[model samples]
Target: MTKEAWDGTVTKKSRGLLDGSSMYRRLELRLTDGSTVKVRVSRDLWDAVSEGDQVTKAAGEDPVKQ
Candidate 1:
C-alpha cells in the first residue's frame, strides 16, 4: 500500500480527533512542488473540498475536485 501521487491547492480544511474516539479528515496542501503537505482524507473527500480547491490524488485514488 505504497502508491502516491499529488497535485494540490486547497490550503486547509480540517477535522480532528484520533485517540479520543477516532475521527479524522484533513487536507492542507500547497503542492505542485512548492511543498506543504498534510493529508488524511475521506469522509467523502472531506466533504468534496473547499479552500482554494484544486486537487488531485492519483495513486490508488480518492481525492478529486479539480
Candidate 2:
C-alpha cells in the first residue's frame, strides 16, 4: 500500500484497542487537498512519517518514463 503523511484533524474517535494489545491507536488523516482525498492512516504510519522530513511515494518514478 502507498504511504504518505498529511495534515488532517480527527473528526471523530471512539475508544478501542487492536488485537487486545495495549498499543492505543486511532484512524487519522492528512488530506492532500480539500477535494476529500484525505489520506487514511494510522498512528503507527504517522510515527514513521514523523521520523522523516517529507512523505514520499513511488520514489524516483514517473509513469511517463515507462
Q: State every prediction's TM-score relative to the real structure.
A: 0.32, 0.31
Residue pairs in collision within model 1: none
- Residue-wise C-alpha lDDT for candidate 2, range 1-66, written one tens digit per residue: 443334443333333566697655333333346422323345555444432123323433311100
For candidate 1, the lDDT comes to 0.86
Off by over 4 Å in 1: 1-19, 27-30, 39-42, 46-64
Question: Candidates' lDDT values, in order?
Answer: 0.86, 0.36
lDDT of 1 at 51: 94
**Backbone collision count in every prediction?**
0, 1
Q: List RMSD in Å for every model shown.
A: 10.1, 8.8
lDDT of 1 by residue, 1-66 (tens): 237888999988889797789898889999989999988888887898789989888898777788
Which is the leading candidate under TM-score? 1
Clashes of 2: 1
